[model samples]
Target: MLCIKKPSVASSFEELIPKILTEGDLVETEFGERTKEIRNTIIEITNPKLKKVPEKYPLGEKAVEEYRKNLLYGSKNIFSYDYHERLFEYPYNEERINQIDYIIEKLNQQKNSRRAIAITWNPKIDIEVSKDERGSVPCLQFIEFLVRDNNLHMTVVFRSNDALLAYVANALGLISLGEYIAEKTNTQLKSYVHHSVSMHVYIDRDRDYIKKYFPEYLKYIE
Candidate 1:
């Protein structure tokens, strides 16, 4: 039920942080976790307004472009893909699956299908207790897409989501995915619904920064 609608990334990121902080639960993550205090939460972008990104607001142009480049590929960058194993590294295996292509094909064939789910978490790979040394395991769990009334909407789920840095970018990244599929499916991009079990600002690291940023964003939201 925590949701916000913004016309651009520049405008949206500001709004998302506050929601995470407000709606988030003060929980602690498991051992080998990066930070101390965590906020487990959920967020929804009722309207992504991808139409205003880059060209219009641009936000942090250089940074956003770098991020955009990393995410645009069908391959992995700091993000994810490949039930195709597109990434050369990671668990260091060869088998793969193109989730993007799979979802696109599913929607192309059946517009009303609920079977359009693409998952990134592998129980064997992700839950390996011996692989504790690995730096990245995946915060993203899966993404589902639905088309209704000629509009394509996305539901994004995450096992652990970073509140400040990763929250907005993750939403934007998924929005990009939804946009791509919508174009292929010939539907309008409606919105993005985001659920993060851990949508938290790392309190020990970001408390001061988060507090400072809040009042400023508060005014903007007010």
Candidate 2:
């Protein structure tokens, strides 16, 4: 199973910076070389502790064979075209309003300090294809969220985004939501993500960053 935990605030971004160091990392693959390289670079950028380049990347043929089993895969089940069409066609409707309410309810039910978020980036339905000379298909969904200590945090999801191009916008959007929810709840809103394919890929990209610059985070793991 894929597990994504809430992000607890650090005393400061700098303190959080040291936790992403990279040392003694190991991954071997040719097919995954680009992914691994991006991972390493991100670690290097965030954590200064590693000082040296990792040796396991751009792996040997033998190493790739050995690690093949560890590679990730996803569902092949096809969706009704209606499924994809609806996400774009009726993004904001009564159904979506209920969904936002449901997420708030889930947080209230948790009885813990953690807050929840639902991400709606199903790749099966949200593929980005060129639309025209002046424009293109929507790349991601848009949503708003707020964090408050004892109130329901608000989050709004948008359709279509260029992952790298719009990363900052998405990040800030969630942060704002966490803050807003916290104020409404009269308690700190702990940040969380609802899993969707787009988010999955974003996190994978983030994982690469953590591996490259924040290996110390791996140590904090249990």
**Top candidate (lDDT):** 1
Per-candidate TM-scores read: 0.73, 0.32
Q: List residue ranges in candidate 1 displaced over 4 A.
A: 1-16, 19-25, 31-40, 50-61, 74-94, 129-134, 215-222
Candidate 1 accuracy as lDDT: 0.60
Local accuracy of candidate 1 as per-residue lDDT tens digits, 1-222? 455555555465666566655554455555433342233344556667653443222133454444445655533433323322422122335555566777778888989889888776766666673266544566777788998887898887787766666655566766776787898899988877777765556655555555565644333222
lDDT of each: 0.60, 0.33
In candidate 1 the C-alpha lDDT for residue 6 amounts to 54
> Which residue runs does candidate 2 get wrong by more than 4 Å?
1-94, 113-115, 122-165, 190-222
